[model samples]
Target chain A: MGIIDGKTICQVALVVKDLDKTVEEYAKLFGVPKPEAFRVPEESVAHTQFKGAPSKTRARLAVFDLGQVVLEITEPDEEPSSWKDFLEKNGDGIHHIAFMTDDRDAAVKYFEKNDMPVRHYGEYEGGNYTVFDSKEKLGTFVQVKYEPKK
Target chain B: MGIIDGKTICQVALVVKDLDKTVEEYAKLFGVPKPEAFRVPEESVAHTQFKGAPSKTRARLAVFDLGQVVLEITEPDEEPSSWKDFLEKNGDGIHHIAFMTDDRDAAVKYFEKNDMPVRHYGEYEGGNYTVFDSKEKLGTFVQVKYEPKK
Candidate 1:
């Protein structure tokens, strides 16, 4: 199977300058409840990298639903992340499109073989997930939204 | 009844430099078929406005499904269009997030009241649609993807 099997565009991630206000605006835009904002617990993500370096970057996250695909809004907090990069360069806009799959390792390898290299590797729910450097190849980055086996 | 009524983000539209190449690249990325390319025939749309004036612009379109939301890739002709504006400014990335609705007029009015003014308006398939000027308010533009009565 290809890198896309069992995977779907499950999220559209945006880098916002003001997390709370953006969340409120999106809630009004979607007629949905204001997303509860929180910082990603550092312990939950492991082996994280930014620009190919080991990263201890922190960011605030706000999540909401748009059908099955979630909208992930991020605001970098003192961390040099792609979120900060997007905000500094583009002000605010979509940063990445994420695909959810159980077979993230295989998907990562397949994409790597296809010339998209993994920029970041992380553990969520004790499982593996990766961010592929697809900006040059696809005009935007891609995330392997995986939850590790419990 | 808010600006969003039975409306969900059902599409993410991108303005690309090359229609055929982008479609082929996306098909390979998703393991989906190459979407048939098309142009939004001028006669198919009525009362269209671009940059606050009546428009006779033409653009190519290629669409495919990405889970519940559709991915629409656009290549504007020589006409001055938002697509061309995006290409000149950002090269290629998401241009707008479209929320599907049946009540086009009310939705447009609601957003206008909420400070998101209409940037563009037109009819496709005899249905009304609008792009809201939300780049300042929401970081990215928003579209009222409505199917209006003929």
Candidate 2:
């Protein structure tokens, strides 16, 4: 089996300049009610890390659950995070495709062994996620999210 | 209903520098055999049009069928197609997310009415497709492919 199951892709994320506008546009395009954009929780809650150190990286985020996969739109703050870096360098574009993993550490290790090291890591209410620098090989960053069973 | 059914996303396509390398890496990452890259057919067969005029834009393409959505990789020629333009301006990255549509022209008109015009149009063996300049609002190009009932 592959280190990461590509078939389990759960989300495709984009970094944008305007979170509200993009959310509205996507809602209109998809004929869904416009979902509100919410800010990522404070560092005390999210425990975000950039590179290898704790960082105050946060963003305004919105999601559209388009049945098969969730679409994520993020507008990052001026902090040193992967989202901010990608937005600054590539403008509004796809940032990463994320897959759900039962073992986030193992997935990260596999990617690291292949020379795609972690760029950012963070936690949310239900799960933690890691982004990898897989752009050189995959043409975009890859993310693995782990949410344990309740 | 939305003009285009976003839930029907059939493909997420990326523009890359090396089609073979990307395909191989993805195969390794997914634990699948590498799919061969094939050059897009000649204009006579593809009937390609860019910005409303007949054009000879082509690319080497490969795909990974990841169940819910197909992942497409393209290495465009130095032609004036949307793929080439995105590669030149943005380097290697996600180019478009495509939906399967029964009425491709109407979908194009819907996007055009919302100020997103067609960037490219082409036909293949069993279907045709249109690419739109939806990046201004949607943050990336959107495509609709139509294959008639067999």
Candidate 3:
């Protein structure tokens, strides 16, 4: 089976310059109310790591559940996270398309074996995520999130 | 109701530097056989227009139907099309997220009224599509396709 055998795309995230303005525009486009924007928690809580080193990367985020997939809008700080890197290199555009994997470790290893190693990784309340440097092949980074069974 | 009152996103398109290589990688990533690549027909057949002028823009395209949303990879030629412009300005990345709209003309009018005018438009075999310059606020162009009932 392919590393990501499931076909469900969980999320599509974009890095923008202005969080509020982008959120408003999306809200209007989708004909929905603007979801509240929240900042990524501090490094102490988020434990974000970039390229194997702990980094204090944070971003203002707003999410819209567009039924089929979640749409994320982010304005990242001047840190070393993947979102920040994308914003600086490509300006405001899609950063990643995320998929949920049952075995994060195995999936990451498969990508590494294919020469697309992990670029950034972090933890949330229920799950941990890895960002692969798959842009060379995929034209965009692929983020795999794993929420292990409790 | 929002301009796009639909929650189902039909497609997400990306611009790539090499269509063959990218399609191969994506096929492996999704554990599927490589879909054949096809060149967009000439302007006479496609009737492509960019910024209100007839333009001969062509691209090699490969598509993967990932259930919930279709993934389209395009490599544009040295022509004046939306795909070409995005490739020149942003390298290779996500170009547009498209939705099916029942009333495409009205949706285009709404976007234009909001200062996001149509950047490119063209006809396919069964439908016509319009791309909006919504990147300033939405971080990526939004394309709406209209296929009228016969």
Indicate which candidate wins on lDDT: 2
lDDT of 1: 0.76
lDDT of each: 0.76, 0.88, 0.87
Q: Report the lDDT tens digits of candidate 2 across residue range A23-70.
A: 988888888998778888789999999888888877889998866798
What stretches of model 3 exceed 4 Å from their correct place?
none
Q: Which stretches of candidate 1 lie over 4 Å from their true place?
A: A5-7, A43-45, A126-128, B5-7, B43-46
- Give one digit per residue, the lDDT tens place, for model 1 in B19-126: 888787778867777878987668445666766877676789999877678888888887766777777888778888888787777787787888888887777775
Model 2 B-chain TM: 0.96
Q: What tens digits encode model 1's per-residue C-alpha lDDT throughout A1-150?
A: 346741388888888889888888878766778878987558336656776776676688889877767888888877666677778888888888888777776787777887888776656555565778776666677888777555
Residue-level lDDT for A23 in candidate 2: 90
* Recovered share of real interface contacts in candidate 3: 0.74
The segments of candidate 2 whose C-alpha lies over 4 angstroms from its true place after superposition are: none
How close is each model in CA RMSD to the real structure? 2.3, 1.3, 1.3
Local error of candidate 3 at residue B149 (angstroms): 1.8
Interface RMSD of each: 2.5, 1.0, 1.4
